[model samples]
Target: MTDKTLRSVTIERTGAGHFTATNARGGEIRFGTSSDPDGGADFTPVELLLAAIGGCTAADVDVATGRHSEPTGFTVTVTGDKISDELGNRMTDLAVTFSVAFPDGELGDRARAILPRAVKTSHDRLCTVSRTVEIGTPVTATVADA
Candidate 1:
């Protein structure tokens, strides 16, 4: 991966009721004011941050499983709850949970030995987004058979 940094983004009104957001490199995102008229048109940056964690975790799972010869596929779901300050204002803390699903077949001992390390390495060392969120949020993961 290159040492690319997402420095800044720009948002502009593009239509009668919509707006477009663009990054420094010309990457654009479109949104509308329908959701929260006061809050603004696109998804909040916090929402995008959650998405980044989920996407990175899923991708790491795929690669880790393949590297381990598991050669399987899985689905991941991430959920978060936010805590606010005394004034009933903005979020002060966030708790993030992840659920990972694997195939139904039982691999017994083999899976038991490798799965934990795969997940640990991904969250503890590899995934950039997970590392980023771990800075301010409490992140946890649960693995299940599907």
Candidate 2:
């Protein structure tokens, strides 16, 4: 078996119930406690899961595209289904929709073919959030032709 150490992140309240989350790598994100019945002002823990997956997917696409001759900006849309009961809510399934736009007459069909591969690589290997969810949650993706 391989040995792995748990990574740590620290969260501190910067103001009245508002906070900042800091990772071991020094990356920080803002978070707030909720008071609104509309569920605004707070970054619900569940939302972070989606953001984690989406962000990783986007980064994966970008990195993979960069290795190719024609790299372009990419967008990813993710929708998730959650289960709720007296216990709480948990994600049940997730769908990631990718919309990739390349410059007209870009790098021809080759780049297009490679794009899909990159996205797959991210989900298969690079995206921690996606893989974590995949163990218990269903994950799906659809590629858009540019």
Candidate 3:
């Protein structure tokens, strides 16, 4: 038997190219189409995807480094390139850059030393979002008549 945790989200159209997505926990987010005819005031799907990946890895790195020293500041920038193929447009290469600051001293030294390993650990296994993307998890869709 396999241990599995089920997660689900529901999305409903709000307006032209605008939608609201709600999770089982009752959390909700609004999003819109990325292209012209501008959808809504919220993040687009691709932007949200980048945020998820960045946020996941950032959390993992923060916790790992916290054992040595709590970072005084931290920020992550994620970027990707859109490419075209027979399948249409999709993000091709993605990059994540983390900027972290620590208190100056031995603690800072230790934190710096641990940074690379922490990032590697997150990308290799810890971050659920990035790992899912890297592994190409299968997604199945079903349609029901209304």
Q: Indicate which candidate wins on lDDT.
A: 3
lDDT of 2 by residue, 17-70 (tens): 678889978998876666366755667556677788899888877766655545
Global fold similarity of model 2 (TM-score): 0.71
Order candidates by TM-score, high to low.
Answer: 3, 2, 1
TM-score of decoy 3:
0.88
Cα lDDT computed for each candidate against the true fold: 0.62, 0.74, 0.90
Candidate 1: 10-residue stretch with minimal lDDT? 89-98
Better of 1 and 2 by TM-score: 2
Better of 2 and 3 by TM-score: 3
Clash pairs for candidate 3: none
| Best model per TM-score | 3
In model 3, where is the ten-residue run with the lowest total lDDT?
33-42
lDDT of 1: 0.62
Clash pairs detected, candidate 2 = none
In angstroms, the error of model 2 at 67 is 2.2
lDDT of 2: 0.74
lDDT accuracy of residue 128 in candidate 2: 79
